[model samples]
Target: MSELGLPLSEQSLQQAHNGSREEVMRVFDEQHFGRHHAKRSVAQLEEELQKAYKNFILANEYKSSKLCEALYTRCEDKMDQLQVLRLPSMAKFNAGFLLCNRSFEEECVGPSKTIYEQRMKKMLGKSRSLFIKEYNHRLFNWLVAFSLVMVVMGRFVIKFILLEIGAWVLFIFLETYTRMFWSAESLYYNPGWHFIVAIWETLVYSPIIDLDRWAILIGVMLVILVLYWRCYGRRKHGGSWLLPLYRNHEGGSNRWRSD
Candidate 1:
């Protein structure tokens, strides 16, 4: 009730304070039901009364502390009821797997900025700074530019340079995530139908969903491909300039042949 600063909310809370428990509950239910604008609600109202209990505790608190145990009680029962109705996936009110938003521990009450890799998530989404942080590294960018120029000249195999090295970093991250269950308490900890719903929220977005992005990415990929085909920076006799392990040696012309 302290959180309700709005005039309407204050009025509703005041009404609850003055009315009988049953009357207060009826009003609360009416407000919740009307707020949702649900024509026909499928989920059952929770019989365990919370609003009434809150009022009861507050009214009796001045008399004795022993009569009220508000601290031990859950606070989001109304919010939870509204949330169940808002979810649109099922015919009946139910959360699916992977993204059920259910937690073993209680979530925080106040809004907090979400951080990803030391940058604010909202900023990262709105800007290219996170992905292109290395643009200031002149030597690295120069090398990449040189490689792309080589790709344009006629050696197609140069594209593999990044793929092979990138795989090592990707492998390390994947291995770390696979072992994260102990600390993170991943959905992997609970295997059932609901677990599928729990994971969906985490995977809310993917780049492939947008056709414009797909076309732009494909265009860039094609350009990179053609450049690589023209200049892969391979040796005269054939072999990668950077990767020597698979290079042709002793008059062997086969670039892929490793003796």
Candidate 2:
């Protein structure tokens, strides 16, 4: 990682240099050579100054660029490690945000406020767009989740839950018939393998679900879907119920608030 870090550092430094070079040249040409001198005549001298400054930095070998590269590598390592962990995704996201902010400030913001503002604005705009895009994604996810809930309820409970012991006996007879003729697995398949495993692990270690739990699960999901839909609709149109409504202390209604 350290070996790789050096070249990454060099590239970032080069980018930093490139971004500021024209601005630096403009200022140097104006101040050093004065406005009376022709701008085209100073191009060679400007290139010399840029090369000298870069070479001097390399010769002196400052650690800021290297530190930025190390920080980036560490952040990448953390992300890769977190992918294997069961920790909450939000926590991982926050950690990543912190890492970027740290690296950005350390590497780029030290030069000038103008540079910092441009970098920060670009970073923040990208983040805001990403957040909105993810919000839209979660709405679709909620619809899928609700549909899955309905499918599970219809398949397991509505179809099989009311069957009596007589039905079981019939199923056994059919099983015997099928085993003799067809030579295949049982007809009544359990779709919830993970849920069954969870129940078993709970009893041995927490409680398992039986046949009667589907209705209650469906009800809970319905309530969740309603809440999610309400929130999602509000957010899509620039309102949010999750955020508390406070009387504007700034002495204004919606328009004033926007301003």
Candidate 3:
């Protein structure tokens, strides 16, 4: 028996090598349960058995270790044989095979194509969700910072506008430079750039008095939202809808709840 009380004797190793996977697993469970008395689960026992089997194979010189190596070699051979058997038919292959073949692009080609599309869609959805989440967080921080700057420069409207315009120009320059340096695709499809452009255009075209009024309105609304969030929203729902564009995994906007 090994230190973990696993039966690693020559006889037990032979039984494990010759028997089915389940039978060997059952033996491992029995030995582990006998010593530990259900302190470990079946999965834990199986994992431990795998670890012991690996150690046994690594020992290399012992009879039981040789048997363990032989068992692994046999399992690998069986897997290779199964793979070889599957090579003849396209239908027997995996999603990757179907995806790589351009001929399979026709609709209702096979279940593999459908499975591949579903997997790709799921992967893209998760990636888009993560991108949106990060974008929202960055945008929120930017908004708060700009709002604070607006408050500090509120009385001096022209100075604030000049500062903001400069900032926007710098941002655009950096974005363009980075995209060019990396040979990245056009920013036309990017929502963040779209938002930035929309805001910049609004700022550029709007009247000075109108801009000041809008700024004051936004600041007041932000203050009221922050106060409400601190007093009630945080304690109640553990969430905030301060960013309306923010979406949950279900693609639904978070809404303020009434008590």
Candidate 4:
């Protein structure tokens, strides 16, 4: 109360009715009045004054307290602005409000301690359960998203591997046909183990698929794709896995460059 320019919490609560907006603003400014803590204070004041206002009306106070009305309105506006915050932010604001208004709670005690204690327990338990449910909901959403991503990546990887193997199969067929044409009379060129061995050897040495010889090539490509969208294929019409070598058809003073 001293910090708020009033000796008693009740006096501070009624300060606005006495035309002391300056004193209230001064107190807030002096406290640094950050968004979270300020909202917390406003929320506490709103709840307390609402109860007081109800009691005043019940007692047939014909003239409403201007100070209470103004204070309540101020707190209500701040709380409305603070509605953008989620559960965690709201919880933190509530905590700060409780801490800041500890003096008010200590000064004003209702006649029934048992009723107050029961209400406090019920509110705290309900709040705890609500926050726990929110946490679980967020966790479940994240897990579902993660699972979807994993499934997509897994499918892509499997497809890529099968395509690579199919490429190797095609290359073997072409190589065997070419060798038969090159050495038709040779014993090793006949349809036998020698032809299969030759295709295997060619695949091992093939410049196009040299990286494909390793089992972890799929993992390597995934890393590369993530690092550079389109991987190393950021060229006109999108480049190949191995960039195509185009013939130099232009007649000029010979000039060449290497990547």
Q: Tens digit of lDDT per residue, candidate 4, span 1-259?
A: 2233222233333554344445555676677558888888867765665665455333322222333333334444443433322222333435434542343245323233234445444544554455444543442333334444554443453234444444455445444654767632342334653554455435433435442235367658777775464343445434343533333458856757568
Alpha-carbon lDDT of model 1: 0.36
What tens-digit string does per-residue lDDT give for candidate 3 at 1-259?
Answer: 2432232444455455445447766776666635455555666756766776666544423443344334334433433332342112112222223332322233222213344445445543443454444443444345445645654443242233545555555455545644676632344346765675467435523434333326567779987886686578656965543433222367445556689
> What is candidate 3's local distance difference test score?
0.45
TM per model? 0.21, 0.27, 0.19, 0.24
Taking every candidate in turn, the Cα RMSD to the unseen true structure, in Å, is 20.9, 23.3, 24.3, 24.5
Across 103-173, the per-residue lDDT of candidate 1 in tens digits comes to 20123111111111122223223223322232223222333454445443323344444554554443443
lDDT, model 2, position 142: 39
Candidate 2 yields a Cα-based lDDT of 0.46
How good is model 1 by TM-score?
Answer: 0.21
Clashing pairs counted in every model? 27, 2, 0, 2
Per TM-score, the best of the predicted structures is: 2
Please state the error at residue 134 of candidate 1 in Å. Answer: 28
Q: What is the total number of backbone clashes in candidate 3?
A: 0
Descending-TM-score candidate ranking: 2, 4, 1, 3
Q: What would the per-residue lDDT of candidate 2 be over residues 2-85, giving only the tens digit for each residue? A: 122332344555665665666766777667755556466576767776776566445324444445445545655554543432
